[model samples]
Each structure stands twice: as structure tokens, then as C-alpha cells.
Target chain A: MQETRLDTARIRAARQVIDPIFLDTPLYRCEALEPVLGCAVSIKLETANPVRSFKARGTELVASLLAGRAAVCASAGNLGQALAWSGRGRGLDVTVVASRFAPAAKLDRIRALDARLELVDGDFDMARERAAAIARSDGIRLVEDSLDIETCEGAATIGLELVDAAPPFDAVLIALGGGALATGVGHVVKTWAPGVEVICVQPLGAPAMTHSWHQRRVVTTDSTDTIADGVAGRRPIPAVLDDLLVVADDAVLVREESIVAGMRMLLDHAGLVVEPSAALGIAAILEDRDRFADRHVATIVCGGNVDMDAYHRWVGARS
Target chain B: MQETRLDTARIRAARQVIDPIFLDTPLYRCEALEPVLGCAVSIKLETANPVRSFKARGTELVASLLAGRAAVCASAGNLGQALAWSGRGRGLDVTVVASRFAPAAKLDRIRALDARLELVDGDFDMARERAAAIARSDGIRLVEDSLDIETCEGAATIGLELVDAAPPFDAVLIALGGGALATGVGHVVKTWAPGVEVICVQPLGAPAMTHSWHQRRVVTTDSTDTIADGVAGRRPIPAVLDDLLVVADDAVLVREESIVAGMRMLLDHAGLVVEPSAALGIAAILEDRDRFADRHVATIVCGGNVDMDAYHRWVGARS
Candidate 1:
């Protein structure tokens, strides 16, 4: 297999295809948070997207490529909603195989998009297997986040937008799942702004990417539990792992509680409605503020698809 | 007093001053809602702003003009938080006099901006009286929403941005309170897009603006109460009334339940968090879907500052 790198050329191509559908989300300097962290902390608010997540960029790209074909994917929440929206917009039939663990609000959104919903009995991995089988049988396009080159290319546009919007940031923090966003964004940042650091944040319970980066091999876990359902996947695609190893500067594993706190912080101070997965980068920063001191740091708010019940519970507990 | 119409010249001036401080919120077609509404429905999503409201634009404009002077304002929620944020950013001392009826989350946000908060005993009118008194006694600039031409001009920038972003719209729906946003936006829309109909939506419990429009005078009520606290003021400012008489096409009062449902609709379908005042426009559309059939209409989502407790209750009621 050829190693894929999200270079400037790929980012340019991605922008040409994805710009119409994807929002160039704002990268605003957090004056209040900057003083607390001792750094010029900024937030790349991906939650401002039409689908309320960065997943829309990748899904839009992949959907556009599959112009006339049906699409199939599996997700706990955000990715499925993004695919459904993009697929619907492009006049493609989308079938989302979702785990029972998926948030109800997300399921409602997928249904509202008029996409077929298949509820799997087991975990996200099991749902992924069902989607893969269906896609293979029906000749539907499978838009895998990690393995798909188009997806990586689409995610890389974030880096392009960031560079165009603000000056060279000292560090960029991204939430890690199957490593597509981290690898894609990291590659672009390193290419365009070589001095910048790329830090990946993962849930402690689901640190497959972190472990893979440390061991220099692809890794998978049998089970992982975290509030960041969007980025709780255990397996890493080999292609994404290869790119991440080359470009990522460091990785941080954030606690579930901290992710919740990060969401609260954004809602309180920044007036942003972000899900736990989207808050991972902020959680990592809050965990180790000293690392970002005196630097111009940026963090991606990956998505906002929190379950209302769960959100209420989290808010109540915090109070 | 002279009627303050935000003509093209004033709008251009406002845009020059406000472009740097405020986000030019996207005016995108809502494809999903279009099919349901049988029209080309566009949404001007002000919830995408850094402060999560269009009020930020007006507040930033007013704060910049103040130039480090002490300022005071009264709000049910969104306006106070916006002023506090803009004032803090511009190094101005801000005192927000909020009513007991305001959302706790909004008060929290105002405090987070380092504004001095005075929680008044009564409703918005009482709070405004207190704010006016404080402003007079302390020699602070009073940033009243309606009477301030700068604030109205700042809010008019939304119309300019919308016209620049999309094709001519047939109609626009705005949530009305102190009427700065509705009046300002109406002025520009009527001037630039002459055929466009400007409709103002107010909560039935607090129909001061609607009554004023119908009676052809500024009207005041003994009391006003509604979930849309941001627009629940009793008395209408003379300037706002004059602007409304000249520019507005009609006014509609939405039920409190419908406002809650509209907020939920936005959260579920659009994945955007909007407060009750922001939901009023959507509520109007939902109430009379036939009026917009096959027409190109735009609605302004004015703010996002609901308390978690109140939000939970609304969600609970729906379930």
C-alpha cells in the first residue's frame, strides 16, 4: 500500500471540492483562556459547521465523489449525521448502521435527513462490520474516515483555512479517533508551518492512536468506554497510523471528567455548544497548561452532537 | 426626537466599524427545511457568533464608540452578556443590570466577562430603570438598545452581509424586543431589496412591539412575561417605533410553547443552540408554513443564551 500524505496540493484540491458545502469555521483568540493557560490560546470552532461538526467536511468530500452512488457508514453519532446530511444534499441514498450506544438525538438527526438507519445490537465496531458487509453486498460506497484518501484530503482543508485565517500558530491540538483528522491536519501544518507543533488528544480509555504512535505499529482494543463517543473507536487504520507517526509531535490522553469540564468551560466562557469529543483538545490543554505557556496555541472543536439527557446529567453533576 | 433609519450610508459606516469586531454570520439556504416548508428558506444564523448572538455586533459597536468609558445596560440575558463581552474586550468598565427573570447561564456569562452585575428585583422594565439611574448618577454611558442609533446601525450590518452573500430574499423574519435588530435590519432590507417583506415576531405575553406597530404608537404594558425573556420588555422606545412604522411590513406574536418547540427544532435539525428570542422567527414560520410556500425567505436567529435548568425543563416537557 502506498503511504498517503496530505500535502498542499491535496489541501487545494479538497478546498475546491469542499468549500461550497463546508463552513470556514472561525479561529478566534480566547483572551480569557489565554491568561489562564499563560498562552495566546485560540479555538478553531468546527462546531459552527452546518452539521455542527468537522465531520461534515470529510463526509461532504466523500459524498461528492460518490455523486451517483449510494453510501454506507457506521457511527456512534456525529459521523453518521454528517454523512446523512451530505449524502442527502448530493441526492445519494445513505444507510447508517449505528450502535445502540449512539445518542438518540444523533439518531433523530440521521432520520430527519431521510437516511436509512440500521440499529446494531453490539458496539461501534460491530456496527462498522455490518455497514461494511452491507456496502459490499449492495455495491454501495463505503466512506471510511481513516482508510479513505478523499476523507484525509477533505479534513486537511481545516489546516488550509486556519493558515489563511490567522498567523502561524505555535501548536495545534486535535482530537484523535481513527487518526484521519490528526494525520491530515498535522501533515498540512508541518508542511505549511514547519515550526508548529501538532498534538493529538485521545480519551484515556480509548488510546489506540496514542499506543500505536508510541509502539510504531497499528493497535486495537477489545473494549473502550468514554464520554467522547465520537472519538471512542479502538482500531486505527494502518495508512492513518503511518502518516500520524511521521507528522504528530506528541499525544495526550485526557480523562473523561476533564472532557466534560472542557465542554462546560466552552459553554460558559466562549458561549459554544460542543460535545465531549469536540472538547478533547481543550481538555488536554486544561490538563497541562504549562506546556502551552507563552505560545500561540490552537485547538479544534471537532463536533457538537451531545445527547440531551446525558448533557443534562453532566451539567447537573457538575453543579 | 428624530427617527433613526439606518440608511445605506449609515449601514456602510456601521459595516466598516463592525466588520473587524463581529463575525459576518453566514446566510445559507436550509435545504432540509426548504422541502418541509415548500420554499427556499434561508437562515441567517447569528448563533454562530463568538458571543453566540447578533447582539454582539451592536454591543461591540457601542463599546468601541464608548472608548474606555464606563457603560451600563439592562437585559433579560443576551444583550447584557454581549455588552459585557464587548466592553471587556475594549477595556471598558461595564455594569449589567439584569432582572431576576433573566437566565442564570446568561448572568454567568456576563460575570465571566468581568462585568459588574446588579440583579434587580422585578422584571426587565425595573432593571432598565435601575440601569438608567446608575448611568445618570455615575456619569456612565447608557447603552440602551432602541434609542442608540449606533446600536441600530451596527445591527443593520446583518442585512448588508446577507444581501452580499445571497440572492434577493422575498421576506425576512426578525425577533423583536427593544426593536433595534428588527428596525435596523428592516431599514436596510427595504432600502436595498425593496420587494422584501420584513416581519417582526414577538412573544404573545410581551407583545409591546406588536401592539405599538398596530396602534401606531409606542405602547407600554403593566407587566410582561414570557420564555423569550430577551424580547419581553413592556415599553417600546420612540426611535424603534418610528423605524418600525416606516420599514416593517407586519408583526406576529408567537405562543410560548411554540418558541420552546422552535428552539428544539433548531437544536435537533440544525444542531444549533438558540435562545427563545432567536426561536420566535422560526416559530412564526412553523405556524404559517403556507405563507412561505415556494418563496425565498430568510429568518434571523437572534441569540443563544438559555439556562441549562430552563432548557432541561423545556426538553422534559416535550418528552
Candidate 2:
């Protein structure tokens, strides 16, 4: 398991260059959540950053190494915001290829940050393919978010912070999308404290990574359907899946209902306005508190970019 | 003006004892608010703490000095939550006297933190009188939030962080309540960057501190009415007023409508779910962006305890 793209040295060095604003985020226990989880749950709030997501770390890292070249990526969501926010400051040109279904609020923010948006009439995966093709045709760098080792290394700073804040946690629950965040944090925790458990959380509707781990190969789902849009993946990146295999100890699948509830619980108990994808960790813990009982658990509340109306509808519907 | 309470040395020392969770809050540029405010605005989010307010720093510091002795406070608000949160871990008894009109959501949190709540059938001012009377009759330590110099020094850690962050800022707007946070942060900014302007913000309906500063004495309002309940002070503590004179360069009064709009603006722009009182700094900047044009201004988003209904009323009113 020699990580060429994100070795110990590379991950450590990445810390020097990733947006300083993305580093040293607040990591503390939500006391009200502690009772429900039956453990001391220390959560690192990645929602406080410019993009209100951990994508800023990875995107900033990519921008720092772009050598002034134009870059393009496909994201209907958080990744686009990250690219837009980080790339604009570096004076690098960025174009995000998004599906027609991308939220208008997200599109507005991406445009606000000076990133060009190219909307493709297809599903997210199709839009991603078009983005890669466009990058190849135009001689621009394409950001393969989950497969980029540099991106993973950049996100490892979160693990670095978590380890430094409180070592020897019993378990860490990370949301599983393309497996970038999960593997990045899992790598650090496994390297630093080998005995600790690293768990990945995914929506039951989009369990590509979960099935990949179970079947011992990268598996793509037929159709992805989940309210946690950030973690809803229909396809798995092979390299990221392999990385997850090397670093993660377990995976958990959660219901969309629980995710909706978890988002509300987080808002009510912790005063954290995180999106459903970010609430997956808490959703996982809430799904089975007995497993994490009396253990010190660490999770990342990774994003808060949900639109005001959409959030109200989701949370209000549940309430 | 010789400062006895919040000198640099004491402020530094207070950081050591206050809950680690309350220190090193996220201070970064809110790029979205920059266009509206007409400057580079660096906002320190004080809402990330357990109690969702900057009061944790002050209360934790005061609790550190109490050495397990019983402490009582008059607050149906942030201070009570802070005392209950910081005191519970230290095995210190905390009693909160709340006015009948105090928000139930806040009272519920204070009670959840293991603090005893005594309801007084009157206004907030009457509740404060009862708390003072109870402390005297019961021989319990009274935690007079604004009057306690240790609390001021404790809250000064914010100043410490702010100075370390973006020093030499042209202006800093702090919400003026009982004046502890304003004075604490103002003292630090003024000490480190003497040329920097320190402006305090108060609700137009509750301009006691602003009027007191103008009169060079404590000012009492006949009737205090504002939606920004956290900063709606009917009377100013003399010592806090004097502290303001030493540290603050100016005080600004904002209309309640502007405060509501500021709350919506902050939520829409910064993804920060802060309360009306916490929105005062941004409210001040929005009041007269021309005055702060081209300045490197920093403001604290000091609390986030707004209930779901209240948050919707404020944020929904705009969107």
C-alpha cells in the first residue's frame, strides 16, 4: 500500500500550501449530541470555510500546483464552489461543467466567484465525462477530484488536526462519496493510531463504495438517488476505492430518512447548519449508538452550502 | 486610563484556563460580505463553541478562578448557558434567574447544561435584581458578567486572536451589550494597533452605552425595546462604560430593521447562523459602508443561539 500520490511527506508538505483559512478549523465535542451517540463526539466543523466544505482544502492544493495553467472540473455542487473560490484568488481560469439539474443557488455562487459554468444536458456522470473531454480538447488541466492523490493529501490536513487535538479516539466516521475524504482521514488515523477504527458512511441509495468494499472491487451503482447530494455517487474511482480498502475498517449505509433527521438534530442540538451529506457521520452514529457507546468518536461536519429554501423545505418537512 | 483587568499579560494568562473549545475560533474574510460592506471584512465566528457564544470564554475564565465554589448568574441568555456549560465540568453549582419573558429555547439549553433555573415573573431587569438578592442571601458567588474584571480579561482572548490574525486593521466593529466583549476585543486591537479605530454597535432602541459614552457617564434608558435582545441594554455598568472609554473610538446605533436585515444578510452571505445581537457588527458596517470604505475591518459573529422559529422569521423575511 505504497501511496505514491499522497505519501507521508507529500501530505505533510501539502499542509504548507493549502488555503490557511481551511486549516485549523474548530474541533470540539457537541455535548448535546454526546448523550444520543453515547460517547464523546468531537466534530471538526469544515462548514466555516469560504466554500463551507472540505473541498476547499483539496481544490486549493490543486490550484497551488497548477503552474498557472487553466483548469476545469465537473461539479454541480461543493467542488465547483471550492474551485471557484480558490482559483479566483490565484488568478487561474476555472470552468465548471455542471449538469442542467445543478441548483441555481450553487450556480449563482460559482458564478459570483468568477468561475465559468458550462451546463451539459445529461446526468452528473455524463457531465463529468464531457468535462474530461473538454479538458483534453482544450489542453486545460482536469480535476479528477476523488482520484487525485494530491487532493487526498490536502484533505489529510483534517486528519492531522483531529489527531493533534485528541489522539486515540476509538473510531472516526467519515462520509463516503468518491472515497477521497474517507481515505484521506482514514490514512492519517491508521498511520498515527493503528488500533483505532476508521468507518465510512454512505447513503443506502448510492452505496457504490460500500458494495465495492464488500465485493472486493470498484463497483458502480445503476442509479444514484439520495437527498445527500454531495455523497451520492453512481460511479466509483478505482484508485480511491483501493485507497479506501487500505485505510478503512468498516462501512455503514444509512437511510435518507435518518439523514434528514440527523440534519435537524445537528441544527437543533449543536447549532450547526450542515447539509445532509455532512450529517452522514452523525446519521451513522445515530443509526447504531450501541456500537459507539462510551467510545471517543471523531467526525467531520464537512459542508454547509445548502440553499436557504431547500434547507427549510428538507428540515421543515421532517419537523 | 490604567487598565487593571484586561492588560495583555492577564489576557494571555486567561487563555490558559478557559475551555480549549472556546479558544482559537475561526477568523477569516467573508468574501460575500465584502461587496456589501465595501471593504475586506474578517469575521471571527464565536458561534462554534458549546454554548454558541463568546460568553463561554469569559464564563470559563471566571469558573477557572472560582475553584469549584458555587456560582450564580442572572441571565435568560448566553451568559447563563456559558456558566452552565463551563461550570458543569468543573463540578460547580450554577443557578440562573430568568425573566418570565425569556426565550424557552435558551432556558432549555441552560437547564440541559445542569444549571438550575429560577423563573421570576417580571422583566429581565427584575430577574437580575432577584439573582443579586439570591446571591446575597444564600452566600453564593455572584458572577456579575460585565462587572467581573476576570471575565473581561477572559473575553480578551478574542482580542488576542484578532490581533494575531489581521493586525493594523483600519476599523473593528464590536457589538456593545454589557460592554465586556467590546472592551475586551477593543483593548487588544487598540493596544496592538493604536491607529486602528474601535467602534461599538448598539441597537437604536437600547442605546444606553452609546449615550453613556457621549455623556461620559453611565446612561439609563426609560424603556429598552429591540429584537437584538442580546445587546438591548436598559442600563450600562459604570466600570464597563469606563472600559469602553479607554478602548473604543466610537459607538454606532443601528435600527432594529437594519439588525433584522443584517441577520438575513449574514446568513445569505456568510453561511453563518448567528443571532440578531451577533449581527450588530455587520449591521454597523451596512449602516454606513461609505465610512468604512477601503478599510480592513474585522467584526465578531459573537453568538448563534437563535431558535429555529426565530431564525426562520429573520432569515425568511428577506428571502
Best by lDDT: 2
My TM-score estimates for the predictions, one after another, are: 0.86, 0.94
Error of 1 at A253 (Å): 2.1
Residues B129-163, candidate 2: write the lDDT tens digits: 98999999999998887789877877788888877
What is the model-wide C-alpha lDDT for candidate 1? 0.80
Displacement of residue A33 (Cα, Å) in model 1 is: 6.9
Interface RMSD of each: 4.5, 3.3
**What is the TM-score (0 to 1) of candidate 2?**
0.94
Off by over 4 Å in 2: A1-5, A35-39, A317-319, B1-5, B317-319
lDDT tens readout by residue for model 1, A1-319: 1245665676787777774536566677766455556677778877655566788778878888787679898887777888888888788789999988788878877897888999999878888899999999998888777678777777888888776655678999999997778888887877778688899999998988899998999889988889888888877878789898888999889998888888877765565667888888888888998888788888998887777668756645332
How would you encode candidate 1's per-residue C-alpha lDDT over B240-272 as one tens digit per residue? Answer: 798888889999998988888778776655656
